[model samples]
Target: MRRRARELAMRALFAHTQGGVDLEEALRHALEEMGGEDDPYGDPLDEEGVAFARRLLFGYKAHQEEVDRVLKETVEGWDFGQMSKTDLTVLRLAAYEMLHEPTPFAPLIEVAVKIAKRYGGEHSGAFVNGVLGRLFRRIQEGEVKAAPKED
Candidate 1:
């Protein structure tokens, strides 16, 4: 159920991002359409899972510029415009989490790859993994701090 919530969040993000609608409204609309507590994809996520998705969305919105900067800085050759929106949204969300959340890199990376494979281009899983893995290593080596210290 949590997974489904993540996927749903991803889907909504893809919609807002690619469609260029207001992201928050688009996400809310998408979640509403995804069906209720008995959603067929799985048991509707519990409140915790739903809340997590919202938290992720808010975080993504709050720090998207920084996340995109990190992606542009970390990815060697690929430009943001050259990437698929699915891949971009997935990376943006993961990048925000990497910077702000205490979630471990391994599971976070796994989830990002899963999201990419499920929603992005065929190469998105590997692409996201490669980029995010490098960032994770930099963080581990103390070469980078999440988003600089918050004031």
Candidate 2:
């Protein structure tokens, strides 16, 4: 359920950032598409899953500036413009969760890697894993602080 929520949040983030869609609209569309008849593997999120997805989406939006800043500083070699959108979106979602959610870092990173591998370029899983691993270390070392919880 959490993994599905993360995937939906990533898709909604991509739609909002890259496609210039309104955030709420993007989320609604993502939810609809996920449950739409065309998606063979689509299992619509349960209510709890939907709430989690909303938390991720709004939480990320609430802290996008800080999230992007952290990502810009943490990512090695590739600039934001050079990274795959899917990979970047996955990173952003994971980063946001790292900064706010109480979930353990290992599973968060694992889920992000899986999502990247499923929806991203050839090396996206590795790229996301490496970057997120570094970010997690920074958090552990107190270089990054968790953002205040959103209302």
Candidate 3:
């Protein structure tokens, strides 16, 4: 159920981002569509899981410039500007979790790959996996901070 909600959120975010709508407004719209004051998932998600997705969404929005810079720099020869809006947004969201969230790298990477496969290009899973694998290693090695201080 939570996964479904996440997918919905991702899809909405992707649409808004690609269409150049305001991100915070888009998120607020997502929250409202999902039942602003209600438990929209039906099943109760653990606080950790709910928080994980929310943090990923907020962090992605908050640090979009930096995130895109990393994407631009790390993708080497891959033009993110030319990618599908859906693919780019999914990549950004998963990259946010992979780099910024307090979860383990492996699980985050796996989830990202799955999302790419489910919603992106035929080879998007591998593409996302490769990018995130290298990025995760850099973070683990202290070459980069997953994200700036979450203040």
What's the best-to-worst order under lDDT?
2, 1, 3
- Model 1 misplaced stretches (Cα beyond 4 Å): 35-40, 147-151
Instruction: List pairs with backbone clashes in candidate 2.
Output: none
The candidate maximizing lDDT is 2
Q: Which candidate is the best by TM-score?
A: 2
lDDT by residue for model 1 (1-151), tens: 6566667678778788888878778777777767666556545666787788888888888888877887788888889888888888888888888888767777878988988997778899999999899988878788768744322
Model 2 lDDT per residue over 26-118, tens place: 999999888678777687799999899999999999999999999999998989999999999999999999998877888989999999999
Clashes of 3: 0
Candidate 3: segments with Cα more than 4 A from true spot: 28-52, 147-151
Error of model 1, residue 40, in angstroms: 7.3
- Cα-lDDT of candidate 3: 0.68
Pick the winner on lDDT between candidates 1 and 3: 1
Candidate 2 lowest-lDDT run of ten: 142-151
TM-scores for all predictions: 0.85, 0.93, 0.73
Residue 130 CA displacement from its true place in model 3, Å: 1.0
Please report how far candidate 1 places residue 38 from its true position, in Å: 14
Per-residue CA lDDT of candidate 3, range 23-122, in tens? Answer: 6666556555553345344454455645655667778888788888777766755797677666677778767765666666666567677777887888
Instruction: Report lDDT (Cα) of residue 41, candidate 1.
Output: 59
